[model samples]
Target: MKRVLCLTLALLSFIPAVLRAQEPAAPQEGLNTVMQKASYIIGRQFGADIKSNLPNVDVKALLEGINEAIEGKPSQLTEEQIQATRVELQKVMIAEQMKMAEADKKKGLDFLAENAKKPNVKTTKSGLQYIVEKEGTGAMPKETDDVVCHYKGELIDGTVFDSSYERGEPARFPVNGVIQGWQEALQLMKQGAKWKLFIPSELAYGERGNPAIPPNSVLVFDIELLEVLPPAANK
Candidate 1:
């Protein structure tokens, strides 16, 4: 379910294009057209999934609630409340997708565990699974540590999205400024140490696609920790 959720979230970015093309210009009436389109997509998708997953889900009432929330007249919910509801709806979608991702991940891991001589992967509490290669020995950096590092980041498909090593420049940043995966993993490495890290989507960017990375991406990084900047030098 976790694996499926991750994958589904990643795939949702692709859905907007298909849905937009099929959906005609929304009714130019009471509700804001843009909000109506967004609400329609979200409500319809959730309604369809609930019908399939939970037999008891009242799709009609659920949709009416969404529409009423969107309408925002006689204002039962404030503007902030309406926005919060939308965010909550999105989270529900993500949660359902995550459930599916977990199931798919288990199946994938099971197959690999059965077939491979030594499958190097472990699932974490947050439903993130990873394979660690070449454990490093040295002092790991804390979230506050300023560090110099060389890394090549890639998607599961071997597409090289970003690389400091390729650019011939070690990147510099405070460890906490990066994604949660990097925050956790870099803390495990020290100066002059190199490690290969396989990061799960939840630890990386679960649903949101950053500038280079797509949604639900499992990222691989060949990371070399060059130096941990001292306080004076960091300034």
Candidate 2:
């Protein structure tokens, strides 16, 4: 039942163009209408996405399934076949993800080992590494203190995932409310301090990463402590 539902969903994904045909695509002389241009652009994006994720696709079978679904016709494949496909696809995906995660873990371990040897970088017992960019004159924040700070988070490959400076605003949050790595760093930082942090996966999001992050990723952050406020009222 679940496999049939998954197959049904896969077909439904391609039929949205028919369901949301509010603005029609005109005759294909020159892509004149907004809907027509959108259709082509969306097709390109979807093609790229499917090419990457659904590796070694059977194009003929895929198109046949899509066409039948759009035309409201019966499925060509039997329930048993669909179930087999679902089970195999799931296994393949799990294997690929595990392989990737293992590679990332090894990469992170090597990176931390090399980074800890740098004269400027300080390593804590928890495997958090940091370089003090600028010393601060203000008092250090307690774990309960709310701090306003700007930070840029990135992967080891220099892919920026999050940044307060890019958003043109500083963020205010309790020191202990964040990930273990950030919590450790915030307590050690005083107002007006600047530091670059290398956070291991164990202290970061770890195996269960969010949409913006991947599993077993080693994260780097450039952090500036602006000001430390009293503990939040709700806290």
Candidate 3:
């Protein structure tokens, strides 16, 4: 196979370099000394790569395969067997991920149900909830309008995922282009208003959450509507 030939040539290239290198008279050695160092370096690099990519590797089987390969023995598994093992692993990983998503969805629903009963919390028809911290007298932004706002987003457990306040700058975006929760809430918010929003996962990132957010996560945000930009300004 091409892969086997490539690997063989790579190993063979190291031999000539090791042979050409001069050694001290007292410690005259050949390719064996160089091979020991090369083996250690390769093993260390492979170990690091495996730990980073596959934390739950089978150490015994991995070592056995490496030993057998180094001893020039034929592979114990056929190509078909290797592909089948990989497919099975993928299936198991998917099953575990789905199980976790289901658990998270149930937890989110329970938390939202309890949170809906809190004083000052107002729920919209779309299941968005908010506590008006500071109501504004200015005009509210429409779906087509662009608005500037400062916000701090967090999970139900109070883990802060993002914050415009920390950066000392407000974010600007089209009202309709944001998550369903933001689009619904922004239309109800007037400029200079500050509100604490409790968003269900369905209204937030849904099942496939963003990088910092987990699947089926309940989100909280302290949002301040700074300015509602005119349609011309957006252009």
Candidate 3 lDDT tens digits, 63-164: 999789869999999999999998997788677778888898898899889989998999999899999999998989999999999999999888999999
The regions of model 2 sitting more than 4 angstroms off are 1-42, 67-74, 232-235
Pairs with steric clashes in candidate 2: none
Give TM-scores for every candidate, taking all chains together and pairing residue i with residue i.
0.48, 0.79, 0.73
Stretches off by above 4 angstroms in model 1 are 1-137
lDDT of 1 by residue, 9-48 (tens): 7546755765566446656775456646555665566555
**TM-score of candidate 1 relative to the true fold:** 0.48
Where's the lowest-lDDT run of ten residues in candidate 3? Answer: 22-31
Q: For residues 1-235, write the lDDT of model 2, one tens digit per residue.
A: 3444554466457557644763654466667665566666655655566667776778888778767976999887899999998899989888888999999999999999999989999999999999999998897889888888999999999999999999999999888889999999988988899999999999999998788888999999999999988765536
The residue-level lDDT of candidate 2 at 10 comes to 62
Q: Write out the backbone clash pairs for model 3.
A: none
